[model samples]
Target: MNLEETYRSLGLSDAEYARVRELLGRTPNFLELSLFSVMWSEHCGYKNSRPLLGRFPSEGGRVLQGPGENAGVVEVGEGWALAFKVESHNHPSAVEPYQGAATGVGGIIRDILAMGARPVAVLDSLRFGDPADGRVRYLFREVVRGIGGYGNPVGVPTVGGEVEFAPAYTGNPLVNAMCVGLLRVEDLMRSRAVGVGNRVILLGARTGRDGIHGATFASDELSGESEARRPNVQVGDPFAGKVLIEACLELRRRDLLVALQDLGAAGITSSASEMAAKGGVGIEIETDRVPLREGGMEPWEVMISESQERMLAVVEPERVEEVLKVAARYGLGAAVVGRVADHGELRVLCGGEVAGSVPAEYLADAPAYEREVVEPEYLKEAQRLDVEEIPVPGDFNAVLLRMLSHPNLCSRRSVWEQYDYQVRTNTVVGPGADAAVMRIKGTKLGYAVVTDGRGKWCYLDPEGGGAATVAEAYRNLSCVGAEPVALTNCLNFGSPEKPAVYYQLARSIEGMSRACEALGTPVVSGNVSLYNETSGGAVYPTPVVGMVGVLEDVSCHATPGFGREGDVVAVVGASGRASLAGSEYLEIVHGRVAGRPPEPDLALEKECADRVRRLIAEGLVDTAHDISSGGLAVALAEMAIAGGVGVEVEVGSGRRPDVELFGEAGGQILIAVPGERWDEVREALAGVPWQIIGRTGGGGLKIGGFVDLKLEELRGAYGRDLFAEETG
Candidate 1:
């Protein structure tokens, strides 16, 4: 059975069935329906997305928990863990970008806090249509400001992430916010509303019309006009979020709560049902007892409302008052809204009337649906074309600058700068660096993280794209002087019913496995989102990859930004004529996107990365950055801006702009070595594809074969025009 049929038998009324049926001709089968519930659910599904989410990496070890739970977890060790997860607010964002994206961040943070961890960082991955689209441009501007507004005030470092523009997302853009927290293994909190007689407390914001029926709202497609969905998009107050984090962590420290869950998505309904089911217990919620910001809400409205900055806690009966005191300390609302029962039913009552009841197990454990696999006809279409036969640009420099200035390749500094990346102060290497690095307080160790995805490439060649995504993440860590230890991923794809989607997923998985095996990086946690399809079409296959590496010395890491004038710039690894078939540069200039990205020779990549690490440690390299995305030109410009210096380089090839500058090449590093140590650095990296592209000088970026532009101009190209002229 497929996804459509399962809903048909759900005993829906003709109208409701027709609505579900008419949403499209397809009805998932029983199993597909179950899987659909899990995958499409606010917890599992990307329904509003049934489009646009095909851009994330969903595999790797340092991962403690992959998708499919309250949150995803990665190993952060000495017997510690970091739980993190990224979820979309497309529908909500469409309704209210500020509150939508803010609460999205707040919600993910609570997921970590509930796991008995202290959130240390937040990352948001965003997408919008071409800024030329007024509505999208407005939404994009507001969303960025909103995410920054919330994350900044709350003190969680908004580290590394990306922004992209594509017409496919015009109608319903995606905003995925991820939060990661630190915890000792022994302190991990589990959500199980166990222990009969435990009081269910609602703390944080008072319930209101805000975010009512968010789950049901999310379980549908966004038709662009989201007036009706406005109430379902929760309002956020990061100040309130900050207090809640402190209160909860304090409560946990005092052992005042038995179990806890964030009131997100389905709000009380989901938290209660899931917690009850997880603990093999039942819950009886009294709606009248729920504190409300406004009066006269219906029982269901109170039960399912997703008001932001709130949490549901199953407190030890004896410690309820103690936990209440913590909320009081934070000046937050606190109320006993329900109680845990030995019976396994999730019951709700209001004004002495039984409003509704259901088996906790049914609500919590939505059936997991396995999908039917069908291959798309496109793979065969792609296979028939000879990659070498594609047209090559006569001038690579023009292509390099075009790609460097492409919205996707441009500097994300504009977006990240608005965010207070240095807020927590633990941030050792903030945004604009290869990976975001943070120091472990009181410890000599440091952590490095980065998120990478190439949706178009993944769409064109899943295996290569997936492998490259992982390799790119590892390379990012290495460039920052950290050794990648583990990985976590979020797999975003479209309807899996089509063999083509399944093929993309399977091939990508193969790529991940092969790359991990070669690099010795293990998969620790992950999440998979499917059914991201819309009436228009499915989103490009996207696998967002998140990686974490460790560095013994926090001070030794490197960033892509320019360091100092007169510093020698050297390119490590072989320079090849990159195939521009599916290049972002090609797409921006030539109006086409297809073909494979540059493939990494794993053996060669490992050797080169190790040598760079050694050189950094030997103090021979002043600064280093990885060559990726927009290739050497972008890399050079980034280094120049970061160091607040200028550079001049000359490649051996007469064709300066060729693959060396614009290609999405991997396993390449640009190092800034002191002129005095240039000889030593060259000798240290002997036998590698290393070359002196140029030296830092002139206070502007000068790519011999490309247009010369001031460092400020190059930075402006990446930051200013990437968005539409008006918006910028």
Candidate 2:
């Protein structure tokens, strides 16, 4: 191939190649070029998103470690720290759903492990096309199986997550996985490769050709021929991953390492270079020393293999044998492939001859493009919807049934049941709840986490969609009575090179930043995945936010379920702001995906969540659920189905029944309290809008005593089988 063809094929632009040459002061060899290709790609380097991502609020006193780390760590009281991060395996999962998603789980687990934390739980945020399409069905099934396949064996509980469906995701489905871990503050480990003479050890699975160009593969958009790139998707061994987690923790417990980094994305190239760059030093790797799974692998292939279940750690030379012994105990491959150096560049040596040499900082810091941003013209039409022009259904009962059966609003028991969510025995609240709560052993501390986002909302109004996502997460944590502390996100979007896509990315961050700042929940660590386009079109901009909260006492927590009869159900926070715009009710019943999503009131959201959290903590509420997706009606239905108890209440207005009952809005939470204690609960939430909407009791769901459905019927519709068949 010609030089330009070579550069373009490597996923490098002409200007990027020229810049590389300038930095190197000469032409580079095949190995050096390959290193730059993967490291500088959007997957490894935040080349396209780094500048835009800075708009997030990322600082707070509780943030022990914020952005630019293996994973963000937060102080969760009692000297316990939580390290968590979310990453997207979109392109890979689209190509090879099983292994792509399985390996994705393995990748994030190691990120927490690298922080010297024991991965405690896993949460996934998924978006797919219409499940009626066989291709979408197959993708959903395999992706869930892959997640359970990896997380179950790896022993991390797949606690809680959210899933939504839309036509825009038909070809470009999104699979964002999050892993949260816990460690003592003193045990936190940084990724920097410090100490010049420390030996860099490669531990766990042997390097393989299965994931050769995985990083570069994830850097671009997919096409009809994308399936042919299956080889670029990593093959994972969760058995190895589970062992590596235990072994690495053992190493940390023994205090045998100076630093640790997981081998993800570009594998050794990224781990080694990022480690060296972070420490302001260098690394000299011997490709021949790395253990390979196959024979006849070239040095360049070995250097940037994107192998799964591997880690690089800097150990004192004197303790090298001890570290190897720990690996041997776990029956993992161990090799001393490199060493920290004072040279300030990552030097690759093959057969004792220099193959590639580049400054570590050069590979770790790719060119950040502040792309031109322009509001999408199509959005003007897409965001325009008249609620008054829409027809209101005569039978609200039938509408409620359809909404319950809608794929986006239906129950996820079939999906989450496949996961061993109780594996670690720390899960106090798992799948059915608004968020997952895990207890800190031997302490009163409880860590609550939830993942939330809506691609359709972002597609309608990126800024509003972004703010709404954060607000939902904050509300979820508050509903469960946890103080939302910090958040990590996975920003999934189409090519940022397009002004429209860049605008979405930029505005979404702005909205999320505002919400985070207002809610006192700062962004910690996150991953931005771009180029999620295919033949069908680009998926909606989905910035999945995973927020983590802390509860002072695990025993005092409220779930989204009715506990007793005659408990009064009340509408709390935000007044008369429900909009049919960008709602599940609008899409399912109206057959349209237009309308500007209701912009979130960040200040009101904070006030509402804070009040709800206080109510739960003070034992004032028996149940709490935030209104989202299908709005107040659907939220009430979910609570009824979960508790096997029904609600009888008056909720709606003179406006269209559909708009008042099923309209989507943020900063509003549905709460249940004893009929006698309603006065006290109302007094506590006096500042926020609080009204008696209904009472919890009976065998039927009755709204204003008009729209009514049997409890068993609601359950039947909500639990409908989603994957009974697959067309793909």
* C-alpha local distance difference test of each model: 0.72, 0.90
Give each prediction's root-mean-square deviation over alpha carbons: 5.5, 1.3
lDDT of 1 by residue, 620-696 (tens): 76488887766677778777777788889986574425454666668888888888888888888888788777788
Which candidate wins on TM-score?
Answer: 2
lDDT of 2 at 8: 84
Worst 10 residues of 2 by lDDT: 719-728
lDDT value for candidate 2?
Answer: 0.90
Off by over 4 Å in 2: 725-728
Q: Each model's TM-score?
A: 0.85, 0.99
Worst 10 residues of 1 by lDDT: 31-40
Model 1, CA-based lDDT: 0.72
What lDDT score is found at residue 416 in candidate 2? 93
Residue 638, candidate 2: C-alpha displacement in angstroms? 0.8
